[model samples]
Target: MGRREIPLDPSAGPVQQLAHALRELRAKAGGPTYRAMAGRSVFSASSLAHAASGRALPSLPLALAYVEACGGDRQEWEARWEAAGRELARSPRDDDGADPPYRGLVCFGQADRELFFGRDDLVDRVVDLMGRRRFVALVGASGSGKSSLLRAGILPALRERPEGAPRLAAVRVTTPGGRHTSEHAARLTTVPAASTEDVLLVVDQFEEVFTLCPERDRFLDLLLTALDEHSRLRVVIAVRADFLGRCAQHPGLAAALRDATVVVGAMSAAELREAVVKPAANAGLIVERALTARIVEETVQEPGGLPLMSHALLETWRRRRGRALTEEMYEAAGGIRGAVATTAEDLFRRLTPSQAGTARRILLRLITPGEGTEDTRRPTDRAELDAASPETAAVLEQLVRARLLTLDGCRVDLAHEALISAWPRYRAWIDQERERLRLHRRLTDDARTWVEHDRDPDTLYRGSRLAAAADAFAGEARQALSSPEAAFLDAGTAARDHESRQTARAARRLRSLTIALSVLLFVALSASLLAWNQGRSSGPRPRFARSGPCLFPPRPTSPVKTALPGP
Candidate 1:
């Protein structure tokens, strides 16, 4: 659809004036869409609109995005967006409840070392590995500092180098649907297939290529092959640790990771402390030692430890007004979950009810398993959404604008796991919907089979009944499996062998004791019988007989006693 052509008037307020000017600029630039404008600017179209409308203040990043899109002076817009952002920061929106401080990757304070600590060694290692092997995979659990380190540490560090150019070409392909993959390839093709010097090409959240990708997908393989084959390009992939196993299932990926792989684990205690404490101090927020210690203690050993946890702490700290961050506040925040929950709730609370419903549906669909495989954690594309409902296109756009869903080409996925796990109601809704979809598919399959085979009336009747039952079962299955609670049940398997070894050992000991006890009892009973017999012999044999046997009784007593004596 064409954009609304609003006439620009000179006499308007600052907010209205900005919007009017932006519209005029778009028209003058051959009827450019927001995407067209946003493509040129550092700010997204939605962010630009929000900023210009005065609904939210513009950020330097947003201004940069907007300016770049409009073909306007980037330096000028940057200064403007920065000024507006500071003003917007002072005035909280009505929907802004006690929300966490994580706005997005752009809003995050990565330039400040305090706000972006840890991963010093890893960053160096990756850069070094790239220099040596021309490729490196930063593999880690979700919430690991892969993205953060790359952006905050590596990118910034590269920019700081005296020899580094002002603009070092870096492309982060987040959403790579099949169609988009071709476009991405085309973009890469334009870069003049690397020379002797390596070009750094980073694929962030590389798992998305698999998670959201369709079956028999060659996009990832092709991209990897291209990078590997190219002599001048250094490819760095940030993939989820869990998905690393899935990647390994492919021979190409297995070989790549083996040659150049660095699995990012939880930061050490010292690192965790630095990550938490430093950022707060830089933001003009005091992080108490006790509070930092508690955060580190609770978070240090956890997978992907301090990144999300640190953000949660900072977010909670921001909401506390002037109060020093305390242990009670930390506990109440649910640590990582609390931070994520707060952020999601803030974002969700800002959305319309309809928007929330669409987001929920998308999440459920994403989590549901296909016939042979599981749904991706990454965002779904139009085709994938069409399998669920017709409104997917509209819903997806709405979600993307809301920042709940990310888009790379046509594919979509949840922004983070906290959104799914944060609210119990949302979690329940997803579970229920997934169950329904599962059941529907099963019923459809059974019905199709029955329709193809039916002949006799009796057979037809039976087939129809069976089909109906299948349908019912499918629905129940969808509802049952959709919920996290049911998922937990499914995941609740017997403990690992190592975990159960102690119990097994105890059982073995009990079995051995039981056998020993039984043997002892048999021996005791035998001894008792033997002792009784011996005592009877020692006491002498008592003989009783009738009158006719009286004569024989005396002989018998003598004979019996003699026989007993022998025994």
Candidate 2:
């Protein structure tokens, strides 16, 4: 009634051995067609047949379902399936040189549109909002896939516009880094008057404007003004949800975001399935159903787990056997929670002592320590790195190759903010030096301000602030400082020392003057007392003399010498 079952050779391999065992179990229960077993179980007939085909190991659930359908012991079959999985994991496989389907700790770009999935509905809603409103804010938590949605979802949809929609003249995306200025905003927001097609501008990581950029208000004003003045200009800004309050500080920007904000939340189970399966399928690979279920179950419970899921999937893909990504590989890659930290720790262990120290400095420099919010990735200029040192450059190269850091032209930053919280060693580094990092951030800002003001003396650190900077940045910590920051600290310290020397000289002069004045005052008092004593002895004498001739002498006698002689 059904196609002949493929014969299995028990001595071939673990897969074949398991397949043969499954067939014997079926025979013991009185052989039945896969269709009959499928009717008794939840799996399809094709899947039941494939489990015994011995082409590859079926997922544990599928294998157990087959066993139970054939009146076999599910517990025994599960053990057999697990044993086969272990044997398969141990077998070495050659690299296929295929590109990974997932973007680990990195946002999807236009080129990755095919591999990006699961945000279809949200993307449509955002596209509709963008079409209706001239300004829209995409708000979501860190690692929530907002950037990926914008780049891989909305950008592609906009380019492939539906019939009767306004054609876009240009679609420009920019991030406002620490140095974004009003001039930069103006350049980004400007629209040609002669151009008839609508222009779409996306500002990704818009929170950076509030956190890093000094001219945040001006940048917001320019964007808002562009929207108000040009009917053809549409602006979308993707910001971390925590920064919505900061955006509200500007009334105009707040009003625009009120009705036009798209919130990216946790992906549903079905969406997560699509996100996990579709990418692997596109790459001609199979993600085991059990692995998919496990990933969905674990990731759904964790808020902001999209990036972690992507990274874990990427790591698992790296360890995949043949064309199948299995649970064994996922576990070997440390699952979702441990995957990132494991990779980071592995890289750290592989580095030399000097290289490890440089790696620490390099990684620490790529983060912007949050004030009231979570820490974020800071894009540093390659020039800012100690690339001159061969060891430092090697560390940077290693990190980039490992996908922990990304190098974009002259800029370098962590591939994602997830790395800051995902890796325990990195997180510990941040926590242990949080106060120092804050001080360094201030020192950096002050240094830039000083340089901008032509190295004004008044801008340099002084007094207690200078002392704090000096203390915190001493020894190895000083290696983290940028050229400008080091220069700023050096200049400030020099100025402070100069002031100290002048104060010491002035103090010495004042002390000498005080001692000299004290000696003169003592000498003058002694001389005045001596003059008074001399005057008293010379000018003042007793006006009366007494004679002791009788028991009672006459009072006030002009001369008492005769009376004294007679007595």
Candidate 3:
């Protein structure tokens, strides 16, 4: 018998399916060309065509939109699209550090162990600086690994405290307004109040003191002073670069930090390979050289420079469904946001239908009423959560486990902005909520003002009603006002102080004017009395003048004398 051959259909691949779907959608769009749809969708026609032409698969959202435009079943198209996406995502990239929370998994080669790599000179410099100056400040942008380097590298090195060394301690001040310095002092004084020169105080996330808790500034200032006064204590602070401007606004802090600052940028290609790739290889993942190069190239791309890029890559690897990661897989994942969203969505999809709804409600409530930011204020009370059904609590627990959200103490927040920005559905919910919040804020402000200003029973009654309406809104606003929001609170306090000073000055001036007017009245009365006395002494008084001028008069006598003389 002749060999039997199975022919593969050209359109069977994801790219072909995407292209076919696009063509069908375009035809149904009643649009002659890609340009027409582009006008409607805000994406270039050529890009859309490329996405649908089987050369590349369309993003899930775009595919859904195209299917809807074509009068196709969106649910059906979405299922197909997701299936295709997963298939394409099976290919793994050959990078050593294909893990979450890092960048350029393959940039650094094999010699780059976590214990040693591109940081030799920098570490030595840091050590030298520490020897020379007890206080050293490390400054970098968020996700630049300032915290990583300090805790992972320097602190570990210092823990041994060489045979003759004094004590060394590391404390992470995560809470902005929380008691940090006292905590530090307490930690230091636990054993004994020893010589001042015996300890190293490493303060991590120092920017939170300014950004999340300005109330802590005085405490931090005192901490800084204590560090300076105590000869034995060495101080090291790590802060985000963005907050440097804020720090500068504080002349005292900016000056203190000016002498010691370090900026972290993307690692060199070699360093990246060492930091990322080699470690993964040690973990037994077989990474291809080409994939490593591709990852490096993508990691260096604009907006892809974040360490979070590594997190996406790692997640993509984990979601490969036991398949190898390839270039096609990478493209199907829709870059970093898509990868993040896909992972989150996968986790979310695992929940029962009811649980999913509960999760959605929790997110909806947590989001700003209108503006779009991932971080929301922690819910003030269980009533806030009770506002959601009991199912929400269960869903929230699930979300925390999924790493989509973080639960710190009683507060819950999205893990990272990338997660929010990655998912269209999530972003949309946040937008709608933000708008709701904005309107609520406006109403709340109006109602609160009415209540504050009127202070009348009737007005208070009306204002209270409005305020009750505003309560939901105020609660949302409070939720929106979180870690970063606290930075603005300082500005608000300054403005309030200025207004109070102006009002007090006005009151003082009014009081002085009233006193001056009273003194002038007293002087005028005394002068009038003196003038009356003088007049009485200088001239003949009326007969009734013994008491005061009265009816009896000397005029009559003068008149009679003149008449007699004339006669």
TM-score on alpha carbons, each prediction: 0.51, 0.78, 0.53
Per-residue lDDT, model 2, residue 331, is: 89
lDDT of 1: 0.56
CA deviation > 4 Å runs, candidate 2? 1-96, 163-166, 227-232, 524-542, 545-567
What's the CA RMSD of model 2 in angstroms? 10.2
lDDT of 1 by residue, 420-451 (tens): 55556667665665655564434333333344
Instruction: Return the lDDT, model 3, position 204.
Output: 67
Report the candidate with higher TM-score, 1 versus 3: 3
For residue 131, model 2's alpha carbon misses the true position, in angstroms, by: 1.3
Q: Between prediction 1 and prediction 2, which has the larger TM-score?
A: 2
Question: Against the hidden true structure, what lDDT does model 3 obtain?
Answer: 0.55
Ranking by lDDT: 2, 1, 3
Candidate 1 at 383: error in angstroms? 10
* Per-residue C-alpha lDDT of model 3 across residues 79-153, encoded as one tens digit per residue: 888777766565333434444323322222222335234454455556556655656788765555565567666
By TM-score rank, best first, the candidates go 2, 3, 1
True-structure RMSD for candidate 1: 21.0
Q: Give the TM-score of candidate 3.
A: 0.53
lDDT of candidate 2 over 44-95, digit per residue (tens): 9999989988988888888999899889887777888888877666442335
Q: How accurate locally, in lDDT, is each candidate?
A: 0.56, 0.86, 0.55
Report how far off residue 13 is in candidate 1 (Å). Answer: 30
